[model samples]
Target: MAKTKTQTATPAPHTRTRTHRALLAAQLSNSVGDGAFYVTSALYFSRIVGLSAPQIGAGLAVAWGIGSLAGVPLGHLADRRGPRGSAVLLALATSAAVASFLLIRSFVPFLLAAALYATAQSGLAAARQALLAGLVEPGARVGMLARLQATLNAGLAVGAALGGLALSLGTRRAYLAVFALDALGFLVCALLLRGLPPLPGAPAASGDEPRLVVLRDRPYAVLTLLNALLLLRLPLLSLALPLWIVQRTSAPGWTVSALFVLNTGAVMLFQVRAARSVTGLPEATRAVGRSGLVMLASCAVFALTAVGLGPWPTVAVLVLGAVLQVVAEMRHSAGSWQIGFALAPADRIGQYQGFYGTGVPLARTLGPLLVTTLLIGWGVPGWLVLGAVFLVAGLVTGPAVRWAEHVRSRAAAPAAGELVKAN
Candidate 1:
């Protein structure tokens, strides 16, 4: 996306600077391969490697856990070192981890490789976000983030198509090709980073070394936790909705694909427009609150799906719900980018971004279990409760963010005074 926003809200692809365009292109390439490999991984493990579905799940869960733990330290490393170098290194590590799947014949090796992959992926995300914060101005960062998200959706769609085509080939080697494709994309992305200015490694003005500033800021930590739950929207659509449609709702099975198409299409077509209002933290907080209300309505509509009105009625309600959910998704994501950037100290953004990014792996890891228990287990009541959580968390964000900024300012006062005295 272009740095300038007003007249052309959605900049043409050619308008962005070379480094900015390259980063966005790398995002698309990486996500395409991820989309393909993700679809194939479970089947490959079960059919080719002789591992059960649960074993595959266990390995992935463990990997994500490891990834979460590794995030902060790696991010701190990026803050000290250059983010450009760290991002390139971890991207290469991610490629190696994906390629290791080719050697997997048993469970132990698979688990080890997966842990490495997940950890490297988490570190890569932290480093990349730091890179963005350094390269992009604060005023334009959230918009840039939304534009990248749109590219990711587009890339995933392409990847999914390719994966389906490969599935038709139906050979073990064909599945392995999917993995190889994902690895190659990472290498490409790493190479692209070589052209980026070593932006993340901006030299820090002398300030206290951060051991765990993010953790100590209780309000900020709380916001991270709440945002993590709000992100359950992802699992709700990708995993729970399909299961709910099949078992509880009277909606036709194919409706699931329709919902995915609508959500993906909305994100690709309108994510930047949705982000325009969120250029700063106050606006972002409002957007988040608005998203919460949308989510509440969507969940309530979804609850109606189980009433069994008829296939068409169920389809209507489900489609409506999906549309609202996409709105919520767009608003929540844009708002989050602003909040994360606003709350982080400029000098320690790599560490703070790393801390903030943890919410993703943490949410993705717990989201399935949470969705299954709340949405699937209890049915209607579960949906209502989920809606309530969104409502509360969304509204709470503004106050929480204000309080975090207060704490951050208070903490910085002593240092400022000390500098003044030295001068």
Candidate 2:
């Protein structure tokens, strides 16, 4: 599980170019599969798989709750080994897990696959981020991450459309295809990084220390909490959206595909421009706050669909809400990028990412249950609650960003040569 540690002379111009191309290609493939899989799962579970909305909600909660716990161990592995090895192994395992879905059709086995998939996903993502940190020139880090996000968005746009089209073939078959594509993407990623220069990180940092020691960092904790809140809303798109389309809207299933298509398009178009405009941590937080306001506004629109709006109008409202939510997601993604890269200790990037990732899954676990309960009881009220959560997230994130800035300034100001590590 160790990486090749051989270092050559500084990477030549052609070498950097080749590596960048390889990484981009791999990312595009991977994200296409990711987008396809998520949308396909939503359609399959809600429509063909015979799971009720609440059951799907519960499954998502359990799967992500398990994922939250799995992050620590996965992080330790990545830190102990190297990013390349971790990413490759996890990618292969994920492929197997996805393939298993074809064999096992019951709830328990499907749940097991979900947990395994989440674990593998966390590992691959952490390794990939770490690898980027390891491989790119320091000056290029910001652009590199931004470019990666943008590329992911592009893949998402294409994947969603393709997955939607596959749905016409039949749910089980479509999902199988999604998994196959994901498997192929991982294989490509593994091949591209296998022989590249090894990532250099700081010495091993133990994660077994008291949780409080890490938790006491108020800013990081707040950031984590807010992220969790944001992730909680994911079911809106993942579960709620498809359900709404089939049960409520007269729009064809094709419309569901179109919504995702638009979401990814927004992300691809706005991400780089958005990142460029917001240059620092505080700025990014403010942007998230503003997007939260937009999300808050959009929720009312979604709620209206349940209020007897015609199919066309409901479809329009749904699209508007999705667009607003994606904008907020873009803001959150940008801020997360800055927080994760800046706050993580040089030697313990995987652990820090693991920590950050835990919050999102934890939030997702709770959100589905809470929202589902509301959906059962209050209907449109549930949608409103999601909007409220985002509002709170935005408000809380503002102070968290300020606190991080304060800590960073105080630590780095007095010591000129040293790196200021946020725990």
Best-fitting candidate, scored by TM-score: 1
Give the CA lDDT, 0 to 100, for residue 143 in model 1.
84
What TM-scores do the predictions have?
A: 0.93, 0.81
Extract clashing residue pairs from model 1.
none
Deviation (Å) of 376 in candidate 2: 6.1
Candidate 2 accuracy as TM-score: 0.81
lDDT of 2 by residue, 213-301 (tens): 33455677678777777776666666566776676656667777687667767777877766765566666677778767777777777
lDDT of 1 at 349: 72
